[model samples]
Target: MTLPGLLSATVAEAIELVGDVRAVRRTLETLVDLGLGYLTLGEDTPALSGGEAQRLKLAGQMGRTQRDAVFVFDEPSVGLHPLDVRTLVHVLDRLVDNGATVLVIEHDLDLIANADWVIDMGPGGGAAGGRLVARGTPEQIAADDDSLTGGHLRRHLGG
Candidate 1:
């Protein structure tokens, strides 16, 4: 198990006290939220994937008390498992809940479905598309017959 997962599994209820156990556990929870529970704490930074490193940076930002901050991520789910992507979505949700504006340029169906709003710009990528092909909640996007993204979303949503 990763250090954060191990620490969380052995919280104050099962572990001996050192100092500020709550703080330690809170930090571990943050790590888990960023999907770092699946990665070893002692792991080398160079060994981390783009997505993992982005999540690490995101976790650092979570410590700030700043509200109304804009957090933009470009394909942060690049190398994550779907389960880890779910965890990352939850972390993003928390940022939104805390009054942060979260914008994710993602292609993951799960992430798209969870978004409050989505603006899909493509009949095709670069040189072929720039006009908005679809814009709305995932449901609306899925219902759009002209959208390639909508077609995939329909299947992803099992509709």
Candidate 2:
């Protein structure tokens, strides 16, 4: 069992520290769902990869009761396998369903495909890439002619 999972399972009743046991368990489940089931609470923070840290930060937000808030993520899919991307998207979707506005700066086609609205920037990278190249639903962006992102997105969707 994961360190957090073990703690929640074995010493939950004794902890009685803050929040309800159910809330703590829910948080643990969210961590496991984000592909962090193998992590131990005592694990060294510096040992985690960038993607693991990002997902761990996201896990902290999953159980919050906040609504109508805006959450921003930058390349949250960095180290995720293709299969794991779906879980990340699901978590983002849950945030939206709970009335949060999620703005993800992501290059992952699968994650972008799940978005309700997309704003694609970058006619080029570096000093040449700050312009808004496209803004619309995934299908609309895929169909746009002037957007470079559109061209790639079209192929990504098998269009």
Taking every candidate in turn, the Cα RMSD to the unseen true structure, in Å, is 4.6, 5.0
Candidate that scores best on lDDT: 1
lDDT per residue (tens digit) for residues 76-97 in model 2? 8887888779988888888999
TM-score, structure 1 vs. true: 0.79
Off-target runs (Cα >4 Å) in candidate 2 are: 1-24
Candidate 1 lDDT, 1-159, residue by residue in tens: 445665444222323332457866666667777767756544678988877788878877887864979988989999888898888888888899888998899899999999999999989988998989989999999999999999999999999
lDDT of each: 0.80, 0.80
Clashing pairs in 1: none
Model 1 CA deviation exceeding 4 Å by range: 1-24
TM-scores for every predicted model: 0.79, 0.80
| Candidate 2 local lDDT, residue 102 | 90
lDDT of 1 at 2: 47
